[model samples]
Structures are given as C-alpha cells and as structure tokens.
Target: MRFIIDVLLTGLAVFLAALVLPDSAVSVAGFGWAIVAGLIISFVNATIGTILRFFTFPLNLLTLGLISFIITVLMVQLTSYFMGSKFDVANFWWAAVFALVVALIQMLLDSLFKSKNRD
Candidate 1:
C-alpha cells in the first residue's frame, strides 16, 4: 500500500542522508537499521512532534519558524536515543545537520513520487 511504500522510501532517504554525512556526525548500521530509524522518526514526528510544534507555534512565529528546526533536531536526538547504536549522532550540531539532510532528502523523494504519481 501507499503507507508501506512511503515508509520504505523514507527509510531509503534516511539511509541516503546518513551516507551523505560523516561517520563521526551521523551513521547507520545498514539499510534495515535505517528503515527502523526512519519509521521511528516518522512516528515521533507524527505524534510527539506535532504536540511540541503546536505548543511552540508562538515561538516559531517570533523566530520566523526557526523553532521548527529546533524541534526537528530534538526529534533526531530522540530517534537516536531510541535506536541506540544502530543510529547515532555525535552531538546537537551533528543532529541538526542530520536533520537538515534528512529533511532535504525526504522532500526530494516526496516531490519525485508526487510527480511520478501525476504522470
């Protein structure tokens, strides 16, 4: 189904993002682990992430939406903590970098899929 494909594609994007970063910054054990991490990230973003974002809406507006980026970084750290060694981030900065990369790749993947779906 579409949901399954989205998860798989998001996992692929996470794996690609991990490869794009330095090992010291972000690293994944393998594709399987990347899938696991990606699913967790998506779930976390959907649930806890939504609540946090809603609460931070005012701050996000004050900062021109910079707070959303912070929320994303925290989500990355939470994902790393849940994943243990399989998915790791060196520190806050690296997690931010990883989050940015993952966001970019996910955006790209979504665009591609949407375009193809329309075609």
Candidate 2:
C-alpha cells in the first residue's frame, strides 16, 4: 500500500514536472503514462542506478558527488526508453532539467505530507 502510494506520488511529481518543462524538452502522453514512467524510473533508480553509482564512486568523489546528477540524467533516459513513445525526453540536458524538476516536486510533496502528518 505504501509503495503504491509512493509510486503514485512520484508519478504526480513526474506529471507536474513535465508540465513545468517545455513540450520539446519533456513530453508525456498522459498522467497514466506518467505513472508508468514513475514506476520505471523508481525501479531503474533503485536497481541499475545503485550499481552504477557504486562503480562510479571514484569519479563521484572527484566531482564532490555531483556525478550523481549525471546518473540521474541517465536514469531519466533509461526510463524514457522503457516508456517508449509514452514519455519522451529531447536530449541529455533536457533530461537533466526534467530530473531536477521531478526531484524538486517530489521533495515539495514529501515535505507537505510530512507537515500534514505532524499536524
């Protein structure tokens, strides 16, 4: 139940971020597609992402952990690949921007939920 809710919320963040970006940068077929994109992103981030990051730790150290941003960008591209035409990213930079926006939106949503829980 919790995992499903988190996935849905991540999907909401993805949808919102897509809207915030230019259509040429990031495009989503619909909210339903966004949800599937979210799942793909989450799964990819958790699995392949983790392994890649571990292997890239040396490079990440040199960049002061900023290499993770590249990892995130790649993750977005991988998600797009899984989503096929349902979700599309224009290129590397656009995917980077999209990933950043999605992270920002998800952070905001998480804080909102945290505040509500505290209330």
Candidate 3:
C-alpha cells in the first residue's frame, strides 16, 4: 500500500515536472504508465542517485548544494534515456526545470506524509 502510494506520488511529481519543463514529455496514454515511469524513476533515484550524491558530496559541499541541481539534471537526462521515445525532454535546462518542480512537490508531499506518519 505504501509502495503504491509512493509510486502515485512519484507519478504526480513527473506530471508536474512535465508541466514546468517545456522540454519534457510524457505519454498521454494515461496515468497508469505515469505510475510505472514513476516507479522506474524512483528506483533510479534511490540506487543511482545515491551513488552519485555520495561521490559528489565534496563538490556538493563546495558549491553549497548547487551541485545537486546539476545532479538532478543528470538524473532527468538519464530518465529520459531510460524511457526512450515515450518520454522526451528538450535539453538540460528543461531537465533542470523538471528537477526543480519535482523536488519542490516531492518535498511538500514528504513533509505532509512524514507528519502524518509520526502521529
């Protein structure tokens, strides 16, 4: 149940990203694929993103977390590649926008859920 909710949230994040970033595109096939894409994206972020963040921690600190934005761009690019033709984005800037929007939404959702779970 939690996993399902997480996936749905991820999909919502992606949908929001698509709205914010002109370069990003998702299939209109419906919310189901969005959820699947979200699951894949979450997995990629968990595994690959963790490793990247660990290795780039020094740079991240040096840049005062600005490097995180670049990392997010990379993640978006990687996601675009993984989704192939179904999901597309124009450029790194578009990825950056997507990352920014998604991060904001995800942070909000996390905060909401965390507070509830604590209760």
lDDT of 3 by residue, 42-89 (tens): 777778888989999999999998887787678767877888766666
Whole-model lDDT per candidate? 0.89, 0.90, 0.71
Q: Candidate 1's residue-wise lDDT over 73-119, tens digit each?
A: 89889999988899998899999888888888989988878744542
The TM-score, computed over Cα atoms with residue i paired to residue i, of candidate 1 is: 0.91
Worst 10 residues of 3 by lDDT: 21-30
Ranking by TM-score: 2, 1, 3
Error of 2 at 72 (Å): 1.2
Extract clashing residue pairs from model 2: none
Give lDDT tens digits, candidate 2, residues 91-118: 9999999988998999999877654444
Evaluate candidate 3 by giving its C-alpha RMSD to the native, one decimal. Answer: 2.7
Lowest-scoring 10 consecutive residues by lDDT in candidate 1?
Answer: 110-119
